[model samples]
Structure formats: C-alpha cells, structure tokens
Target: MLYDAIRFQAFHQDMRIAMIGVKGVPAAMTTGGGIERHVEQLAPRLAGLGHEVTVYVRHYANPRGTKRWNGCTLVTLPTIRRKYLEAIVHVFLSTLHALRQKYDIIHYHGVGPSTLSWIPRVFAPRCRVVITFHSRDQFHEKWNIIARAYLAWGEWTAVRFPHATIAVSHVIQQFCIKLFGVKPFFIPNGVEIPSASIGSDRMKTLGLEPGRYFLGLGRLIPHKAFDDAIRAFRNVPTAMSLAIAGAPGYDMRYAEELYALAELDPRVRLLGFRTGEDLQQLLAHCYAYVCPSRSEGLSIAVLEAMSHGKVVLMSNIPENLELIDHSGMSYEVGNIQDLTRLFTFAAREPALLRERGERARHIVKLHFSWDSIVRQTDSVYESLKA
Candidate 1:
C-alpha cells in the first residue's frame, strides 16, 4: 500500500458513497491527470473514514481490470473511448449503473460529468447528489464552440441541480455565485506530505540529476502552454536541463508542437506520463517545479509540488495565485520572456529558491491535509441528509 495505515474512524456513521467522473484510481493504475489524481487521493481516505466508497472507472483507462484498490471497490465500466465522447459517455452509463445501488451519496467530479447529475436526483430521490466543480471547462481552449456551449450548460446544471455543490477554489466558488446565484461549499484540493524521500533510481533512468533539472508536469494540451516552458528554457544560458513529464491529453497536435519546440534545444526532455514512485522522485528532487497551465480549478500538481518542498514557478492565473497565496514565483501568462526570466533566475539563485520552497512546503503541511479535506467533504454529505 502506498498510503499510511490509519485505523477506521469509528466516530462517524458509515455512508455508502459512489465516486463518478474521473478516469480511475489508484492514479498509478490509470492515465489520470488532475481529476484522476484528485479521486486517487480522495477515495481511499474516505474509506478510511468508515465510508463504503465505490469508484466508477472507465475500462480504457484502467486495462488491468482490477476489482479493488485502497479499501475502495473499483467498478470498471466500458466507454466509447473517443476524445470528446469518452468521459461523458462513461458518466452517462455510470450514473444509470450507480443509481441502481443503495448508495447514500453519488458524487460527480467535473463540470463535464455533472451534466448527468440530475439522473440520480430524479430517480434516486433518497440518494444525495453532490457535484464538484473542478474547473471552468467551458473556457478551456481545446473545446469547439459547440462543445463549449454544451459545457456552459453543464456548468449551469452542476451548481443548480446538485443537492450540494463543492467548489475547489474561491475563484470558482465566487464564479458560481456571480453567474448562477449559487454558493458552493469551498474545499480546496488536498495533498499528502511524503513521509520519506524516494530513491533516485527513477531519476537516473530519465537522465535527470538531482538539483540540476527544473520540472514541468501536466498533460500536453494547448491550454497547458508547455510550448511556453520549452521556449523559455531555450533562452536560458545554462547547462541545467528542463524535464517535462506528461502525455498528450485530448489533442496529439499539441504534443507535436511541444516536440518541435523541444527539438531546438537538447536540454529539454519530455518524459511522458509518469506516476507513482517515478513521479514522486521528480517532485522530491527538482530544483523547482513549473506549471505553465492556462486553466485550472485547483491544481493537485501544484499542491503536490509544494508538499514535496519545491518552489513552484506557475503562471499568474487566478487559480494558481489562490493556491500559492503569492508565495510562489509567477510569470505572466503565455509571456515567454517573463517566464524566461524566472527560468534564468532559477539557474542563478539557489539560496532564494530553497527559502521559498521551504515556506511553500510549510504552508501545505499546515493547511492542506487529505484527512482534513475528507472531514470537510463528510460534513457536506451529512448536511444533505438534513
């Protein structure tokens, strides 16, 4: 088991819960990004809280056909597996299947999956429906106008239709209130502070030297702006390498663009789709972590990086700023020159990086624990009962 063994909390009444919308968990077993990472950490903790948790996973994402993981029941289901159709299609089937079960809570993870949240509300009148607004997906650059409009409706239904709505960020919480007149329970994403340092065997395999390379991690989508990170790193006059870890998300073209940009400089290495011990080593040993994403709700990656005691150089987007509380080094969004300066600074200034990194990790240790987040989510579920 990758988690610490905590005895079941007997104080809270055990509730039957079904988690929908993420690709799968453990995130190690799936090609999970943010939502998968969220569910991966969440489901097991909820189970340890004395709740019976069932996660609906797409078969395409988890091919091994595992039956159980981390004290939670894994119900693997089939999906269409297309770029646009996979998540929604899997969610539609999962909702129908989950409604038949005697669950106390049916929680949906993202705005795209929350479109079918009404099914549980109408059919399973006794079961509480909870939707987490993980991101404002309608604003993401990958969607066509038709898909964007549908996502807009999904966002509307997410807040209004659910029995209780949870927003991962204050920015998202406020957006729901201003646009939909609904106030959601604010629960930021959680991270586990790694108790022990991982060995550098994985790092050596990837040609990454400890404290020598900067790390950028996330899926290779257009909105993530990995090209910006590559372009910026190319301008830095140093031997320090840039190690970017992620796979092509919804579009392959964007990955091609990143590859083309990386070809210009040998210092950039795109290590694809790392998770588990491999990923932890990257976070634990890097000089700093980079998140060049253009959109987010609350980034698990950023929190995880901070939890590993690494300074995060994120784009100065509202969500990123909210997570770091202005404690991190921020570059102007999509400004290669500005990001280049930060990259240059990372090469030049090790002492300041260590100080900021320590403070950032301290903040995560004090504020964002999975145990606390599970309790807050349980409170929301209990509120639905009344």
Candidate 2:
C-alpha cells in the first residue's frame, strides 16, 4: 500500500531490480554517506525509467519509515551493531531475503557486501548479479589484519561472482582488470547541477561567511586525513577559518585525536556531520574545498564541491586526480608540509582560485551527469537480461 500509486505508474514494465549493500537511500537524507548517495540517485531514476526498484537498507538506518523513497521500495532488514560484523551480517540477511524476491537484477554496492554476491548467484541462478566496486575497502587503516584479509577476499569475490561489475573510477576499473582479468563497466558517480540558490542564512547560523572559509567534508576516518587539513590551516597566515564537517565513521580514537587537535587552534571549526542543505550551504559558500584524503573511491564530496563551483584541493591519489581534469590543486599524498604550502598558496591567490573553481564546475558537469550515469547502468542490467 505504501507505494501503491507508484506501483500503478510502474505497472507497465515490472523489471524487478534489487539494490543491496547501501545503508539507505536519498544519500543526503541518510547517514551512509557516498554509497548511500550513489543508490539514492540511481534507484529513483531507474524507477522513473519504468523499472521495479527495491533498495535494501539496514533496520537501524530506517528504524520506523515508509517503504517508499521517491518511487523505489525500501526493505529494512535487521543486523548486528558491531563495527566489524554489521555490514557482513546485514548483507547476509539481505541476500537471504533477496533470494526469494525473484529479481531481474541483484545489484550490490561496496566490496564488503559484494563478498556475499555469490549467495544470490548460487541460490537464485536466474537473477543477474551486479556489484559496484566503490573502492578498495581493505586499504583503509581502520581495519586490522584479519579484517583486511576478509575484505581482500571480498574484493576477489566481487570480481569473480558478479554477472557484471561497475567501477566508479578508471583507477578502480584498471585495478580490477589487472587482478581478475575481468573488465568492469566504467560508470562514474554523478552530481546534480543546482537549479536555485538558498540564501546564506544557514552559513550565518554556523558563524561562517560566504567565500571566506575553507571546507573539508567527509568521514572523520584516518584515511580521509582531516588532521592534515587542520594542521595545514594552522600555518596559513590568513583570517580565513577551516570548517570540517563529518562524523566519526567507526574510528573513535581517530575522531578523538582530531577533536583534540582542532581545540589547539581557534580558527578550526569541527562541525560534525553536516548533510542535506547544511552540507550544500557549506559547499556553495566556501572559498575552496580541501580533500586531504590519502585514499578515495572517486569521492562524492569532491564531485559535489565541484558541482557547486568551488575550487577543490586534494591529495594526488589517482582516484582524486581523475575527477579534477587539471581544474584543481593537489599535494603529495599524506605529506603535511606539501599541504601547508598548498593551503598558503590558496590563501594568497584569490583570482586564480576563482578561475580554478569555474573550471572545476565545468569539468564535473561535462563528465558526471546523473542522467548519463543511470542510463549507462540501465544498459548493464539490460545486457545481463539479454
């Protein structure tokens, strides 16, 4: 009954598609960050294109909610809350639940969840299995030896079991080909061009001014290197402040370290977890967006910043480089001294910075449109169907 109206609209083409592995939909509407956002944009658009879409979200993420998102159905399943066990356990239960759904496509996100893609392949042999390799999860420093080993196995399963695989970046696609000899469809993540501008009232509330602060947005994980931005900001001899917006993602110790470091500098504002309009406001109004991450799987935050017409400063990792197209600045990955120099340069050159921001926006709009991404993804599903 929840999606009754949508069901009627979509009755013409009931191509049942199941999206697994993400916490929830409407990325900015949910807490799962990038992967959630990826599904958020893709699922509803697919539904609009006349497919029956169902996104499996964890129970804790939804708690009590309607089964409908945009036009896609949400199936909330329960899972353990522990850091290491949560994803694997929820993915296991979701895969079991999906086995009975008789879907045309079972699409899994993240390498961690794709480890279980083999289940649907074995049980529901008729269902097409697809996994989107968001990143090399095992590269994250938060995981221990055993955890890394398990994730590496998950990556192997991702390449081996899926009927089709999607790589969010060219770097990831090449990695898959080299390791598994399997070519994945390259479907870059998409960003929306803002139609209307919201006034800076929200920025005012946060004691932030438009085009005055440098923004760092993403999870407060070690690999993200928010600390590098904080330290670099400390040395920049300018009145501009550094606003870091994100929650600690299963790395409490690292989070605590960042907070303590931020306290040492009066200019650093550790605004935890800004999403939706709050996130948009910061991205729209910032002087420059800094991504000091040592690792990435084609960062959504960076693309979003570029979409908002902000200059992006990132670590020189291959994934981050792929997004810029020579429109942004990069430092040596994990080199704080180099980041400090970049920050100082960004502070000094305002006209040049604005020029870069314009180029950044142009590149993202040209290369990463949501409509194009969804259509390409739909083609993958169709290929499997044939």
Candidate 3:
C-alpha cells in the first residue's frame, strides 16, 4: 500500500548502489533474521526505483545461482562458512569487489562489516560510502573478547568513515552520539502486514489448535533469550502450548539445551524454522507473541507480530520499550519470575490481551510503514550526491 502512494519518478536516474554485508536476497528470505529480512525487503524495492542495484552474496548461501533478482544483480563470492570467519571473510572479499565497481552509493550493513567500509572511502573516492548500524553487535554473548573488541572498533569506524550513516532505531542513533560523538540518521526497519488467511492446514500439520499456542519467532541465539521464555511458560498453569519457530545460528550447545528443555514438557513445541505461509499463519493466529531479548535494534520479529494484530509480551529493554508502551506488557530483562507472572496473567485474561493486540497493530500502522522507510532511505542516498 505504501508503494502505491509513492511516485516512481522520484528516484534519481543512472544512480548505482552496491549493497554488501548480507548473505543475499532470496537466500536471506529462507534464513530469517533481521539483517537478512532488511535486505530482502529493501533491495528489490530499490531496483524497482530505477537504480542499478548489485548485491555481493556468499556462494553457499545463494544456491539458486547468480541470476538477477527483480532487476537487481547478485554477485556470488566465496567464504569459509565457519561461525567466526564467515562474515569477516565474506565482507573482506565483498569490499574488495565493490572498490572496483562504478557505484554512486556503497552501503554496508552491521557494525562488524562497517569496519571494512573505509575501503571504498580510500579506493573509490568519488563514490559515497554509507553504513547502517543495525545493532550493538559487541554486546552479543556469542562473540569472544577479541571479536567483541573488534566490533567496538567497528562501531568507531562506522561513524567516522561513512559519508552518511543510518541507524535502524532512535536508541542506536542516541548510542552513536553518546559513544562516538556523532549523530546518525534514524530510519527504522519496516514490515508488511500479512494478507493470507489463517489457514487450518498448517495448524493441523503442526498439531496446533488455532490461537491456542503462544508464538516466539526469530533466530535461536543466546542473546534472544528464548530459554527464559520457555522457563517462564512452565510457570503458567494453562493448557495452552508454547510454540517456538526458529532455526539455530551456529550455537550447537545452546540449541541442544533448548531441545532438551522442549522434551521435558509436552506442551512446549519446538517448531524449527517456519517460513512463508506457515510463518504468516502462526503470526496471524496466536494467543500472544513473546519476545525475551536482552538486546535489540528495533526487532523485526516484534514489528511483524504487531502488524499481525497479536498481543506482545517483551522485556523492558530500551529498544523494545520504544515500540511498545502501554499497548503491550513488559517485565524486567532476564528476570524469570517477573516474566513468568506476566505470562500467567496474559494467559488467564485473553480478552484484555486482545485489546492490547488491537493497539499494537495501530502503533505499527502509524509508525513503521515500509513505504516511508524506502522514501527516507532514498532521500539519504540522494543527499550524499548533493
């Protein structure tokens, strides 16, 4: 709907944009994460706007070959697929490749990849370099001390090297100002409301009774804290099931722990990696959506849930609090007892939860329109040329 409101001629002609950092477009659609989803949504739309868009994707990730996607070109590069080396290796190669291209805007995603953003700044002096600070990656628990230190350094490079910077949330913009003494442009992530009906076929296959399960979606990472949500659900004395829909992200031990926990309770269902219609149906028909993250940069999962008109129960982190006010309930971050009590209250009072769900939808519709995000991002690219 947002696309319908914008004029196609607003985009500048013959402008070239090279997006590095994400795995790829169609590949990102399969592996559901914030950065991945952001690329999948924005890249094709940017190509549709008459810009020459080229994305550097990993060879293994983009299995469908290097075919052009929706007018955008995909350049597959090689990378060692190990957890620590994957991003570093891929980004290094991608940055080197981007330096040789005739691009107007070279945009990088995440602070880690932004560490190399200065490559284009020094080599391709005529091309403007841009980086989107998606999150405070240094705070993620999975990284080692050395990697954490490097990510912190990456944050420093991101603010200084780029011609213009974009922060996905206001919290991240404030973070840039407080830490780096620079204020970056704020352009939050956006989500489309699902148009598909809540079909009962997938529900029956998953042994789910429509609206009887609480939904948790996103990558199964330690920082996400889905374990706390599971523990909290155990305390709630209800017949409702807890369905977690996600895939593990290189943390085998954590995944093992989660699988073990799921086995303890028959009510807990570990629905690994639901996408497309299955994912949309789960979001469309759920008792409530739970997010127990310790850190976030405008969670796309939370936004998608809100867009689906589902009640959200999240932690009191600054990023989550920005999107949810009295419209949804929150507990102390990492406090199991507090979250447990909140879940019990929500399960018991379904009517009250539905009221909040309506408010959540209204909040997303007013604030996080994808059309507005695209237009704002286009303006940022145009300003660089000016």
Candidate 4:
C-alpha cells in the first residue's frame, strides 16, 4: 500500500534493514507477543517498498525454520530456552551474525536487546544502529535483581549507543527526553481498523453469546495483570462472562493459577490461545475488552481492541491512557475496588460502552493505522541515511 505512493523512494540502491530481537515474524495469533506483532506488521510493508528486510528470529520460536514469510527474509538462530537468559543471549548472537552481513541499518527492538546495539556499531562502522525503547523491562516483577540491573543498563546504553532511538509510546518518548536527554522519534504501535465483523462463529464454539462476554487477551504473565481482571469480575456479581484468550508465556505456573482462579467463577472462561480468525471474531462480538496490564511498551492489544470498534476498559497507566485519550473507560492501575466499580457500571450500562466503542473505533482510525506508522518509520530511516 505504501509503495503505490512513491513507488521507490531510494534514488540509488534500496536500503537494507536488519531487525533484531523479535521472537519471530509473520506473527501468529498464538504467540501474540507485541514486538513480534509489530515486526510482522512492519517488515512486510517495508519489503513492499522494495527494501531488503532481514529479521533475526529465535530458533525455538521459529520452529519450522522458515526462510521467508510474506516478503521478508527470516533468519532463524539458536538460543537457550530459559526465561531470563533468552532475550539477551539471542540478541548477542544476532549482533554477531549481523556483523558479517552488509546492511544499511540494524534495528534492535527491546530494552534488553538494545544492550547489544553497541556491538553492531563497533564492528559494522558504516551501518546505522537503531534501537527502539518500548518499555523498561527492569520494573517487571518476573525479572530478578540481576536481570533488572542489566535491563536498566540497557535503557541507559540504548540511548547512547544507537545512532537514533525510537519510542513506541508517548510515555516512553517523554521518559527518554527527561532521563536520557535524548528525544526519541515517536512511532506508536499501529493496527488495522476492521470495516466489518468477520462473524462470531468462533464465539459460539466457545459457548459465548454475541455482545455478552467481556474479553481479555494477552500473554498470561504477571505484568499483564489478568488476575486483577478476574478478581475485579468476581466483585461485579454479573451474569456476563469473562473470556480470556491467550497462550502462556515461559511460565506455565501463571496459567495454572488462572485456571484455578477461573474455577471459582462459572462466568470466567479461559479460552486459551485463539487463532487469527477466531481472535478476530472474538474481538468483533465481545461486550467490551479489558487490558489491565501493569507495564506496556504501547500495547498492541489495546489498539486491536479499539480497531475492532470495542470499548476498552483498561488501567489508568499513562501509556494506556495515551492510546485511548478518553475514548475508552479506565480504572486506577492495580486498584481492585476501582476496577470492580467499573465492571459494575459496565454490566449495568452496556449502552454507555456502546457509545464509547464508536469513539474508540474513531480514535484508532484517526491515529493508529499501520500505513501512517510505516511512513513515519521510513522518514526516520531517511534521517539516519542523511
């Protein structure tokens, strides 16, 4: 779609881009990792513009060893499968691999991965090293003290080492300016605004009624705070169901915890991970979507919910607020009472949510389209080249 405007912007040879630190591209609905989804949306569009895009994917994530997906070249590399060591180790090896290849730009996608941003700069002198600071992973409860310290160093080094930095949320952009004194290019996460419902067949399969069940979707991790959503729902005392659609992350314990929690309430349904069409149908037919994440790098989950004309009931975190801009409802972050009250209000006043859902869809259409994001990212590349 972007290529139709300029055809090809590069006057000389097309720019080569190497993307590091994502789990894998052609992001399936199962993984649902934001960075992978972002790359999946971005890489193919970049490739459409006649640029050579190489994405380094994890061996375990890219199990089939896909050489290519859509238009981008997929490079699968090996790494230990441990939760703590997985990201940094893969990023280290990715940088070493990128050193031998001739590329115009090497983009690292996370705070931990950005620690290796300097490596490409040192070895590949002519290549521009770019880092995207999505969120400070150091604060996540899952990380150990040593990992937290290392991630903090990554946030520090990413700003200094990379030729340019991109912040995925306005909150992150402000943080970079205030703490690091470097103003990062603001390129928030993007989504496609669905024109029509793809039908609710999947919802029926899960025994959910159309426009009845509240939806929660994301990786089942501590930071996602799905437990809070469940707790808040318990306080609501409604006939409406709570359907959480997600696969567990490295930790299966959280999933087990959620299964146990769901046992307490018949209305709560843990649907596990829904495929693409199934997820789309769920988004289309839900009562409202809830995203009570404690931390985010500009959540793709929130944007997708908005994109589907669904009113999102999310925590009042800066990043979440920044996306909705009052288009959706919010409760105090991590406050069970506040969330419970909102859920009660939602159950009583479905009409209010219907009104807000229209506004939420409008907001996404006006600001968060993927085509606009690609143009902005391309401009960032242009600046780096000059």
Q: Candidates' TM-scores?
A: 0.95, 0.95, 0.96, 0.96
Which one wins by lDDT: 2 or 3?
A: 2
Tell me how many clashing residue pairs each candidate has: 0, 0, 0, 0
Superposition error at 56 for model 3 (Å): 1.1
Check candidate 3 and list the clashing pairs.
Answer: none
TM-score of 3: 0.96
Give the alpha carbon lDDT tens digit for every residue of 1-386 in model 4: 58655553533246899999898876784654889889889989888877899999988778888898888898899987788888888989988989998999999998889888888888899999888888888888788899899999989887999999999988999998999899999998899887584877667789899889999988888999999999989989788999998999877899899999999999999998876788888898899999999988888888999888788899998888898877788999999999999988888987888888888889989988898898788778877887
Alpha carbon lDDT at 215, candidate 4: 97
Compared with the true structure, what per-residue lDDT tens digits does model 1 show for residues 171-286?
99999999989999999899989867578888789988998999988888888888999999988999989999988876788899999888899999999888878888998889
Off by over 4 Å in 4: 1-13
C-alpha lDDT values of all predictions: 0.88, 0.88, 0.87, 0.87
Q: Root-mean-square deviation of each candidate, in angstroms? A: 3.3, 4.4, 2.1, 2.0
Per-residue error (Å), model 3, residue 165: 0.6
Backbone clash total, candidate 3? 0
Off by over 4 Å in 2: 1-14
Q: lDDT tens string, model 3, 19-106?
A: 8899777633545478878888888888877789998888877776867887899999999988789998999999888888889999
